[model samples]
Target chain A: MTSVVAQQIPYDSAAPYRSLSLNTATTKRWTLAEAVDGAARAGLGAIGLWRDRVDEVGATTAAKIVADAGLRVSSLCRGGFLTGREHGPAALDDNRRAIDDAATLRTRELVMVMGGIPDRDLAGARARVEERLALLVPYAAERGVRLALEPLHPMFCADRAVISTLAQALSMAEPHPSETVGVVVDTFHLWWDPTLADQIAQAGAAGRISSYQVCDWLNPMAPDPLLSRGMMGDGVIDFAAIGRWVRDAGYRGDVEVEIFNATVWSSDGHEVIETMKRRYRELVLPSLVG
Target chain B: MTSVVAQQIPYDSAAPYRSLSLNTATTKRWTLAEAVDGAARAGLGAIGLWRDRVDEVGATTAAKIVADAGLRVSSLCRGGFLTGREHGPAALDDNRRAIDDAATLRTRELVMVMGGIPDRDLAGARARVEERLALLVPYAAERGVRLALEPLHPMFCADRAVISTLAQALSMAEPHPSETVGVVVDTFHLWWDPTLADQIAQAGAAGRISSYQVCDWLNPMAPDPLLSRGMMGDGVIDFAAIGRWVRDAGYRGDVEVEIFNATVWSSDGHEVIETMKRRYRELVLPSLVG
Candidate 1:
């Protein structure tokens, strides 16, 4: 633990480092070793992983790579999508494997994107999420991994995730212990919520915010909603206000930068990392610390 | 009151038409007279007018057109857009004119789409909406017009309306009386809300639910979010669930079919109206009465 803390050099000692984690999605082209080394080289304290990237190089080797790099695995990308009637068994088995992967990667949080409305039944899809999440709780707890329910933007309710607010995620997570089940506070998905500040506070008070992801919701959302996430300062989200709320909520954890945009992906990975660092320092870091 | 009720032919006497209204936007290319005739010919009891269409023939002539066709003007399309610092006077003047037009058309509800983020300050923009809304309340009340605050979908927070939920709109309308200040529960904008049922009930109890609009939210939202709205059954929205909540909230107002998809707009106006009627009958009407 001492050595791990020693290796994370503060990007600026004057301000010190608030836990900064780089989600691999921000640099989509990077391999596991590249992302781990890149995050470590940039003085970041942690890295968030995607399942496909972990599967590329088996979870064991991926875990060793991150561990050897002296970086913590802040979170694993996803584990839910458990809303299909015909696909339930396979999805549950896949989520179980994701839980094992999270444990192997040395991360407590496994992000869960409850699947979209399977057929035209939004209510049923959401109900399935609650039911499936309950089934996974014991397995996730046994593996020492917390299922982090992520409420995606409402725009994605039909195709991506039906859980569309932190409040909904928290309600779903309420039945379980906070240590076994948690919620993710992703700025891009939730910045537009009117009750955002209060919800963030509630999540904090409940100790349920397992991950704090930062990305911007770009204006005139991309033709494809999936590619509409922008870098921190590129969109209209008021990060300072939201960041302050997260910090005040008692979240002393990794602030992961997770962006998904074609333009961001097409740029040089190293340059993208640099821009993320600069923007975090300029726009988000102060709010968390101030 | 007796004459008004006598003129409204129930689309189906068995069903007891629950204030069926057509927003001119659904038939985008139609002139005010054409839309009025189309709405009346189809036995729709009311019409919701857009300012541009009303301005085309002047409000007095537009009012005469609806009256001649024995249709009530359910609502004027909009009045707010008051987020700009330099455009205050122009916005106020326009809203005042809209109030006059609502009176001229014998409708109490004048829908307001409070403008989106002007510059980068979302809090400031929202504050401006509150301030501007306060200024318009007395003027609206004097004209016997209710400023119906319509919450646009969160997807439109950047370019269109920033008030993104019924809760936010209700909070904004709280300072004024329900008679002069009310809220709109448009299914396309609000079907995704988890607390929707409660909010609708709250609005109903307060007598602040001025209007209820229906349109489906297409899966692959249109390239332009404005054109993403489809006819009721054509998309993935659970109309029955939302329609039930609207009815339970005591909203006996027009369920305005206000779709804006490019395909719907480009089709024959009369055919589009037929599809709207059929979809409403099949998907939305049942929930309201059942």
Candidate 2:
């Protein structure tokens, strides 16, 4: 017979740090240096640099400018597209350059978009991707740059990526247990995953969970092969739940907001960043904290 | 030593009966009786019925008409929206009615659309759905109406269905070990599935594989939600491969063509059915036969 003390736990009203990481595609209108400057001025935490942007500004100069702006590099945008004959030598060479770029930028991860079928042969394409990944893993590991395999949405399965689920990504990375090979779970691609909770947990257990990207899938009237993504909170993604799940899975990484909306990109970049930050603080952070 | 012989299989090179099943939605412009008439006239082996269409012209009458027309009932259109107070009761009642309707029609399967959040609680909504499903299982089992949990696309996850992945649906059906509870693996919903092959195999092994619905996911924009679906070979689904896989998995069910497109519907329903038949003959049936 113990008397229970009535004590109310104080609610944490303050939100988590709304670290703004601008995926350079958000401001494809701006150059790499310009994007870096814009991000710095906007009080952003980091910037995800793309290959084309680096090529445009020259890798060394882009690296220097980013360092100068006092901005952390979130990730290097992509280094995998193992599908076409054009993809063979060209993709490998491009990936090698991307690895070098990631090392130069001091980026934590090099996002890999595993290309899908070239000859409508899915199994063959997947095999080729695995072979390429096996070859690239050692090189990436030696460079101290983790290769984050980004599983594209199944809509992109025909021409973009055969690895269409986070579980599949984890499976792909299982053979290479090294931290060098990891998986990037983007909400746009994986929010629909029924086994999301289990897969995320599995990724955490394996120490292969690299980056957590947030985006909403727009309910388009017609399917556009490219450039039709929703702004976070505007669509039907349980971001807060996902954020909490990922955090619980021991992902102490930055929650990178990566929206690939043509509509949002067409508008003011500054406004979009501010709106995203507000949403991140209000909608996403509370769930994670609780 | 195995010798490669160029032997021509005497099956109709111009027409394939195996790939042809009429989904009533393709002829939404026509009444249920008319659809049955058209299906029988086209010499289609199977036909999928919808609850709304059945309701329009009483379930008993629809059943009689289908039976009179001499067509195999592939599946009955839907029976699950397990969420919300008002909607939940309505949904359960509706599902019971649908089960009865399916049974009356002598349909092999009753497809279930697992409804999304009553309000905005995705996790809670999902739990509610599972609870309701558990309750409905025995009822469905008793009636000999196999409940095929159809996982809707993620875009429909907000308002239409909480169960947006085939794996989730399969998991829900896992508890019920009998063939009474199963899943309908629709290409529109599951083509994007990362673990599609594995899940299909799992569904087959569990004896939960009930029906296979086909509709191409169109690339172009459309205005209506219900009538924007692509016809076979008109969009980007690997039907041949999927059909082969389904056949290999021992799915001896109807390859039902269920296209919900305004363009096709506005055109002659007979022509639409004919085009689907042609595509089935040329592209789909060959893959299954192989």
Residue B138 of model 1 has an lDDT of 89
The candidate maximizing DockQ is 1
TM-score of 1: 0.95
Compose the digit string of candidate 2's lDDT tens values, residues B1-290.
11111111233435466336798888888888889888888988778888888899888888788888877788888888777755467778878888888877887588888776645457778888788888888777777788888888765776678788777888888888546788888887777665678878878888788888888766442544455478877776788888777767767667788888878889888898889888887667876667
The docking category that best describes candidate 2 is acceptable
Record all residue pairs in model 1 with backbone atoms less than 3 Å apart, i.e. clashing. none
| TM-score of each candidate structure, all chains considered together | 0.95, 0.87
Every candidate's lDDT: 0.86, 0.76
lDDT of 1 by residue, B1-290 (tens): 10111112223436444368899999999999999999888878789899999999898899899989988888888898999866479889988988888888788888999888867788888889999999999888887888999999888888889899999999999999998899999988998888888999999999998888999988877877788899988888889998888888877777788988899889999998888878888888888877
Q: Write the per-residue lDDT of candidate 2 for residues A183-224, one digit (tens) a residue.
A: 998888877666788888888888887787887766542345
